[model samples]
Target: MVLGWRRRKNNNHKGVKQNVEVIVPNHFMCPISLDLMKDPVTLSTGITYDRQNVEKWFDEGNCTCPVTYQIVRNLDMTPNHSLRILTQDWCVENKQHGVERIPTPRIPVSRFDVAELLIQVKASARGLDQYGCLELVHKMKRLGNEMERNKRCIVENGAPGALASAFDAFANDSIERNVNVLEEILSALNWMFPLKLEAHKYLGSKASLTCMVWFLKQQGLSGKEKSIVTLKELLSFGDEKHVEALSEIEGVCELLVEFINKRISPTITKASMRVVWYLVSSSSPCSDKMKLAFVELDLVSSLLDILIESEKSLCEKALAIFESLCSIEQGREKGYSNYLTVPLLVKKILRVSALTTEYCISSIWKMCKLGEKDDEKRVIVEAFHVGAFQKILLVLQVGCGDKIKEKATELLKLMNPYRAHLECIDSDYKNLKRSF
Candidate 1:
């Protein structure tokens, strides 16, 4: 309760009344919180509640009005301007009573407004100057960033599709001159993901696909990282036809590999690797084309380099990519040809994480099992040489999933014959090293 002076008129004159407590009118308080309504809004049920309280009610999944308990037919909360005015007036009258006046809340952007902005975006795409176009995008981005509801409304109204289409158009014309505008468009679209179905189709277009490849090619470009991450998100949307089209694009996977090899930033590297893995693993008959592309680019060598230097998270991603590569014959040959292959795979077992251990052990099995007899024996000998036998034994002893356990047991069986030879070799080396 606030303290204030109350005015009482005598028979002939008015006089000040001191130290009177003021009571807030009941209607001014929220039904839920019993606090004064800061932003009053009336529901379809003809009941007025504080905007915050009503929105919280809806967010909690309540279908009925809090007071009436009747199903709300329409969820729109119309702002009660008159009630707000009165509430503000009351606050002014009680200023000395420590009452604070509520300021008017900013209205959320409506779908119609978003649609109008998108229309302007389309028009800008046609013939507007690059500066003008960029200004519009910046405006749209500002709107999206203003409030969560505004962002949701903007996304729900096809911002992604509009931005993607504009980017595609610019890409088809001349990207060299429109680089800044295109980058801004990409940045705008990045905020709109996970994109709606229509936006996915837009990004999936040939022009958009080519644009993404161009972005990825420009190392150290301002928006290149965003492009990489956006491309990965697009691929993850699981459109088979789009995945196929992307895989068929020349140098797409290769560029991704090159980006990963750069290790410019951990985020960019991880996102690029995810894109590579998804494209090859996506249901594209062009998947083989991508895998071949990756192999030709010497992706295995890059992955091994990453595995040796990376921490646990990057190790997991690199190993996953390695496992996918090893599924094919050329990849297996490439992996085995690297002397670090068996030893590195052995070292990672039961070390990084369960998933990494799985990938490592599985990759080793695939590489050794599918090669020629002589190559197989060589890999086995290398495995024993690297203490792969001892690690696999620990893997079995510590216990694991059936799949990994089977892999570990199989690896032990394959290397069993050479275990003693490996031991003797170790002893001999220990004794023969006279001068180091």
Candidate 2:
């Protein structure tokens, strides 16, 4: 593409150097990426684009040609062989200008090929040797990694359910001998997002839950994070018995708490938090006991640490769990014991999203009371010191739901009596606009 060159002198006349000016022919560039096309393919709209760029555009729910602005009659693309040859020739001619010839792209794998592979995988899961099964899964992963089309093909052919059953099959065998294959399957499954699996076979049983807990215990295992993510997905379709079974599992709660305390990547953090929230927020009686168990494992302090620097979504999840915990006496006691609890809630009052702000206010409300007793005075002083009054007043000014307004009003009443003893100004209350 850089067939032109120029010459210029150094600033101090140290040397004369050739400066190559790179120019790509208009037809050689993809309209979407504005770069020389590596794999030029023509759409049905008679527009040429880089294969990867256009494929990505289609994957994002686009039904019209980006350049033509017309409905795409055909999703298939025809290779622009002439333009590709010209581009490759230009690259070779401009070798000194740092242009590299693009390699020929591979054709996408067919659904029939993926279907055949899934059949082999399912067969291997039933009776193949451990090494054989592992190799097949690695092949699937390689195919998945090679191209997006192959991954979609594999998933559309039911890779998720097959893989889940395969994992369950291996779990039923000698786990110590089949751990390697299990980890490989988990690694492959991790790349396949939005998994659609038969929940009853994957996680509805006690044995499956036990197998998952074993994976969670493998501290040095490569698939621990993936296992948690998979577990969270399964819980979406799980039921009350499943929740109870998780609580009955030995050390499951502790492992979950330890996982949270590790502060791994935010994705894994949110996944693990969601799993806990699902369990603790359930209507089952074990939910209360699980809340107490988490509190005992120092879950409150871990959540506080998450709240201090987490993003909006993860912060909302952490706050949801925090709110669930505060619904109990032991949880509130543990929260009050942590020095950072109230101040962090006050800091996040109006700063995060409305849902997050509601969680914060609800949590703070649960931890405080209205009486003028010594204990109440202590909590009121803490809230006043942290500027809770001003934040709640701001919440009212900014306009909130009736429930939030009611809580804010009650919070204001709690702190108003102690304002004289605290740092609040008279104008802070006098200049207030009551939107409620």
Candidate 3:
């Protein structure tokens, strides 16, 4: 796109030398982009394009050629050497015109090369050779993340199992108990985690989840974030038995709570919150174990802290964890104790997104139900004092979704006569109050 010429003084005192500007020819350009091709590759459809552009088209899951619109009966692209040679020759000829020959691009990786890498990675895992295990993993991670084809090639060639075994072996053999090498291996696996087939394979064979739990406990800050990411992916792809087992891991829940309480990166906090949510997804004992784990770790305070401070997206995640924990008595106790709990829900009502508002009210219902059920007016009294009643009245007026509105309305009915004794700020709710 940059095309210009300049004048330079002649060595022999000739007035000046003209650097002529040249225009790149249309035919010399890629058909798909109309830009001059570096590493021109001819498709099975007989159209030549820059290798990167053509590969991108196919990587987006296309089988037809872009220029001809022909079905690539076979997905093959041949290097258009003649076109490249002519283009390079033109650049050389036009050197005085500010034309620089494009350097030859590196050849794209072949599946054969990927398969060879897996062999070496597997051998390293088996202790056949270990000199460059970290380097090999780095190479595989870069190539795999480069494109869908490379990722598919690596995962399809048993790289996942190799990675899991390498991690387990490293964890077992650490003399200094160092996790630096482990961090590099995990960064690769973390990128395309939750691979369903690999999940079943490693979760069943290597006791990978337990290994991850250990890593979470042992790793430094960087490693801890990566570990949480890996564990969440593992739990997401794991089966019923895997969840049953993970729910029972002694410190897993506490570790997640710690991540939340420490206010680690939002990525880590949300990921940890998700794993806790999954553990509590199942019924009693399994669910109960995770619930107590949250309360025992003082998770309610952490959840409330994040719920108000974070971005809307993350606030929703924190609220989701609160929703699950609030179902248990211990969860309710923690929610009731936190000064921010009732008032936070009060503030979020009709104030945040529809989903957050739903979680907010649900937590309130669970906590305030203690008041509703035990005829204990203390919570109802506190909610009224905290402006929770005003927000609930506002929920009745706004279009906060059916279930949330209904819950808010019913909560009002339950506290019918008292009406929390607070002024309804929203005019719409004042009119709606007659119906309530």
Candidate 4:
């Protein structure tokens, strides 16, 4: 019921001249909320609901009209400025009643304005004095949060390219040898890092990627964490060329291994593992290079240490990376050098979670399942050295997932024939879990 239907306390109402209850108009109410619409917007279904309500629906992954329950082919919500004007005006005229006036909504930044800002930023970044560029970038970051529309506008307008070039300029500029300033630039870039498409192009710039890799090697954990996360984001979308570029960056694998060795934070360890996984998993030219890098850097030792020291989730990630490191001959030698790896896998198998069993089984299986009968005999002997043979017996007894059980059973059969030829003790297996 509109206030237009209010009782005639006096003849002040211009058109309404009836004695009735003061009520709000039904059209003013949001269909979803059953409350008066504030900042009304029209959906593609031609239904007008409160802007906040409709947007909340969309953000929650609902794709249909709240009223019609029909698929919203175009999810765009156009602001019902005219209806909003009427709603606000009605509230103002009904001040004698308890209705509060709806305040005017702030306008979101337009796409054209965002593009114009990007143009200004590109021009300022190219200039010798980057003060203007930094200032403009700060503005862009602020504008980016103002609306999702602005975020899309920023990416579409080539904000990633502009900001990436600016990042390189900041790093190499002699006039501004300020790490804090570079951090600010990187931090601002974080806003778009998670959302931007073709992001590897930004990260692949020569001086810039090198600077980030070197930054990862430095002491500050905060800086390294941010760099790792940004690197992971880029690698998530990285293609063959980016992988090669990453492989070419000196000290990248070494620093990643260093971060894992430090074991300061679960987040840091996971980030490092993700980088290693992406490089190895996205194999092309980088697979062999990355596997060799893992061996050359002696990551096997650090990753092994993490298996013992970290929590369940972190241990799972470490195990995963270790699995990759041992997949190749060089990687296998690196693991063979680390006496703790086989023992650690034996200790952790079926102990962590079903998810980790795959990693542990694969690592242990890769260590033992050999092409040469001589290598098989060698690894089986090494397995006994670290009590791996006994642990395999325990996995058979404990009995985990079918795949894990099968893998353990296979290794057991291989070692069974050698059991009579070689020597082993039951007590070594019992205490092996406590070795780490």
For each candidate, how many residue pairs have backbone atoms clashing (under 3 Å)? 0, 0, 0, 2
Name the better of 1 and 4 by TM-score: 1
User: lDDT at 248 for candidate 3?
Assistant: 64
* Candidate 3: Cα lDDT at 265: 80
**What ranges in model 1 sit over 4 Å off?**
1-29, 32-38, 86-101, 126-133, 218-220, 247-254, 384-406, 416-436
Query: Which residue pairs show backbone clashes in model 1?
Result: none
> Candidate 2: what lDDT?
0.79
TM-score of each: 0.80, 0.76, 0.81, 0.73
Against the true structure, candidate 4 reaches a TM-score of: 0.73
- Give Cα-based local distance difference scores for all models: 0.81, 0.79, 0.71, 0.73
Instruction: Give the poorly placed runs of model 2, Cα more than 4 Å off.
Output: 1-37, 40-49, 60-74, 77-99, 197-205, 219-221, 236-242, 262-270, 301-318, 337-340, 351-356, 369-378, 420-436
Compared with the true structure, the alpha-carbon lDDT of candidate 4 equals 0.73
Clash pairs, candidate 4, are: 1-23, 1-24
Clashes of 1: 0
In candidate 2, clashing pairs total: 0
Q: Name the top TM-score candidate.
A: 3
Each model's Cα RMSD:
7.0, 6.8, 6.2, 7.2
Clashes of 4: 2
What tens digits encode model 4's per-residue C-alpha lDDT throughout 308-376? 656887888878877877778887777776666666776676678866777887787787774356666
- Compose the digit string of candidate 3's lDDT tens values, residues 1-436: 5533343535567666655456777667887777778989888777889987887888789888886788887766788888888989988987865678987765666767877887787677667334467779889877866666678667766777777777666656661343555677777777656556654555433445666677788767777788778777766763656677787677777787887777658778778888877777655357787778778877777777776556887788888888888777888877766666766776776666878888888877777665345533556655666666667777677667787777788777656667545543322221111110
- For candidate 4, the 10 contiguous residues with the lowest summed lDDT are 426-435
lDDT of 1 by residue, 1-436 (tens): 3423354434445465445466788777788778888888899999999988888888889999999999998988899889889988998988766677878777778889999998988888887467778999999888888777788888888888888878878877787888888889988887777987777877888878877778778635557788888888898988878888787677777678877877777778889888888877766677777787898899888888777767898889889888888878889889878877877787788778989988988888887788788877888888788778887888888888898788889989999988665662221121221111
